[model samples]
Target: MRTTFLVIVLLLMRNDAWSFVVYDDSKIWNQDSITFYFLDGTSQQKNEVKRFSQLWQRYTGIKFNFTNKKPSFFNFKKFYKISFKGKNNESTNGAINGLIQFGNLSDNIIFRKTTILHEFGHMLGLAHEHQRQDRPNYLDNKQLVTACMKNQQQSRAWCNENLFKKFYKKVFIQSEYDPNSIMHYDISNITSKDSETNSNIPESLNNSLSFTDKFYIAMLYNPKLDKKTLKKMHKQDIREQQQFEAKANAE
Candidate 1:
């Protein structure tokens, strides 16, 4: 989510981690240990990734195994997957087998840990809190579109879908609208404000998870909760959500 490599040169805004979590149980990694195979990166860079990514492990009780195995067609699905040489930092959300394009960390020491942890949140399947449907309309649609098109060379539709898409919270949302969520982007610089008195800036360049982040991750990966318990919890989430929506419609 954090893109140290791209932030300085490309002016691309990166999303941080934590906050409004994607309550899709299928995306949750049920395994105790997740494997990562890096296709590119030096010892120091790889070590930095390992060291910083451990932050997620500490809270979730999930373990990461690192490797440099040359991926073959036969072994493509083995790793959780990562690449550190890309211009942007990105990752597969949640328990599925996917690649995390972790941006290079050779230069930006300041944002390195933040970038790792943020993308790892995506790797754990947490969506951007800024995009939550429950959030107020903050980003200027016209201004944001112009910026993305001019600066990032992205298309109008791509900008809208990726930058301004609203995620309806009909699914399981274990947390609230945390502006400080790591999965949020600092949009003050990217887009114009809706009102002069208001700004969409986060309180800080968050480097750690919020309390709700730790709580929900702990719940998802709790050692005591077997698969059955997790299933039941997800079912309960759905039932409550339906009741809440129905009550709202009635009102």
Candidate 2:
């Protein structure tokens, strides 16, 4: 019975067309046709791929060309991808999704939805907003700072301010930092003396993708890969993936 349920769940992730909401103010000006090549992987992994593609299409007004391809050594590097594991001891169990290169968790239920969108954020080249130098006022925990300092790249504690301008032909409001964003995380194991003041950060750890996740993906949807944009996004993706793998192995 469990196997049958898993099979049914996997089948849903394999499909191309899916529906979700668009909560942004502006309509995505999807200007191109984007293609997704899904490599052999689990249902959660494939569903993540589909969720991202669907979000990208809706937010960017781009037509998505998708396919499920046999696993290949180079396919992930060649296309947008998501991979999952049953046990990710690196972070929270049932932590659901995280950006692939940024971090990994002890995988549990199907948090494929959040994982796909967050990783796609990395693919779009946005650094973690919590690490912004201007965030000191917003974040008061010394432990959070230490953890962020230890993982500077993943935390995005320091990134070039103009990072996005280099790749975008037209800059939109997607540039602003949004704490409530599904991509954003709440205060984790770190706690504050004044829960009243610090409680603005969601009490529970969160990974659900928000409206902004859908918006920029739609904005950057280019059917014909923009070499410059693709390169920039991929560079970040590879670097973050390496970091996650390194961290995972160290444990």
Alpha-carbon local distance difference test for all models: 0.63, 0.41
**Model 1: how far is 108 from its true place, Å?**
2.2
- Point out where model 1 deviates above 4 Å: 1-20, 71-78, 104-106, 148-155, 189-204, 223-251
Flag clash pairs in model 2.
30-60, 30-61, 33-223, 59-218, 60-218, 88-106, 88-107, 101-240, 101-241
> Residue-wise lDDT of candidate 2 within 1-251, one digit each (tens)?
32343344345442332121111212222224434455346665565566544644444454645567643565333343333443321221111222233134325322444455554544444444454433435464544554443433333332222111112222223245556454454544323334343555555334444444444443344323444654565466446545745665576
Error of 1 at 248 (Å): 49
Best by lDDT: 1
Write down the TM-score for model 1. Answer: 0.69
Lowest lDDT block of 10, candidate 2: 89-98
| Reference-based TM-score, model 2 | 0.44
Per-candidate RMSD, Å: 14.7, 16.2
What global local distance difference test value does model 2 have? 0.41
Cα deviation at 145, candidate 1, in Å, is 3.2
Model 1 scores a C-alpha lDDT of 0.63
Off by over 4 Å in 2: 1-31, 64-78, 85-110, 136-140, 145-176, 189-207, 212-251
* All candidates: TM-score: 0.69, 0.44
